[model samples]
Target: MKILIAEDDLASRKYLDKILSQYGECDLTVNGMEAVEAFLMAWDVGDPYDLICLDIMMPKVDGMRALQAIRDLEKQKGVAEADQTKIIMITALHDTEYVRNSFQKGCEAYAAKPVNTEKLIEVMRQLGLQV
Candidate 1:
């Protein structure tokens, strides 16, 4: 599986990388804009990511905006909803509003910060991604 991990905090980024690396190839991005750019480039090259783990807060675009952009791009490219890439929002924020917005914006799952590896893997499995 191809995965994209977008995170700003170095510790969280490395931690997620360690956990996710066992599952597939991971491309890391430190900001939302870069994440979007990578996503677009991958799609253009017919190498679209199967999963994207985005931090809700980041420099530049921010995860919510990035998620929306990714979904829009998929729609523009005629990717059916069932076939669109899976997105998992990762953040320290546990506010009900953030959770609701994440879902509304097309996040497949949400992982609270200090990510739980087991829970994340379970979510990946739920999404039909080989974990």
Candidate 2:
């Protein structure tokens, strides 16, 4: 699986990369803009990501907007809903509003900050990804 991790915090970025790398190749981005750009570039090259780990708050663009843009692009490109890349919204906020917005924006899962490896893996499995 090819994974894109969009996180602004250095430690969290590294931590997630370390944890997720065991499952697949990971491309890291510092903010939402870079994330979107990377996604577009990958798509153009016919190497779209299998999963995206998006942070909720980032500079240039927020995760919610980034998620919307990606979903819209997929729709515009005529990619089927079942074929769209899986996105997991990762954030420090535990607010129900963020959780609701994430699912509404098309995220497959939501992971709170200080992510648990076991639970994350479980969610990945639930999403039908080989862990």
Candidate 3:
């Protein structure tokens, strides 16, 4: 399971990397633009990520837009819905609007800041990832 973690905060980024590395190889990005670039590069090289943990707010591009771009790219590349990478939107926000928008943008799961390892793992299992 190759995972991409897109987070702007240094501590959050390191925390996620530490937690998620147990499951698979993790590629980290500091912002949404880098995340999208990494995603596209991986796809081009035939090494697409299995999961993407995207932060809602980041520099350059926001997570919502990034998610849309990623989904659109998958569609344009003819990748079926079932084959598309699993995405989990991670944010510090407690706003319901953000949650609603995340689902509407195709995220499989949503994790709040100060993520719980157990719940995250459970969510991964629910997504069919052998974590």
TM-score for each predicted model, relative to the true structure = 0.98, 0.98, 0.98
Candidate 3 Cα RMSD after full superposition onto the native fold (Å): 0.5
State model 3's lDDT.
0.96
How well does candidate 1 score on lDDT at residue 36? 98
Please list all clashing residue pairs in model 3, or write none if there are none.
Answer: none
lDDT of 3 by residue, 1-131 (tens): 99999999999999999999999999999888999999999999999999999999999999999999999999999999999999999999999999999999899999999999999999999999979
Candidate 1 C-alpha error for residue 53, in Å: 0.2
Q: Which ten residues in a row have the lowest lDDT in candidate 2?
A: 30-39
Summarize candidate 2's per-residue lDDT along 27-119 as a digit string, tens digits. Answer: 999988999999999999999999999999999999999999999999999999999999999999989999998999899999998999999
Model 3 misplaced stretches (Cα beyond 4 Å)? none
What TM-score does prediction 2 earn?
0.98
lDDT of each: 0.95, 0.96, 0.96
Candidate 1 C-alpha lDDT tens digits along 1-131: 99999999999999989999999999999999999999999998989999999999999999999999999999898999999999999999979999999999899999998888888999999999998
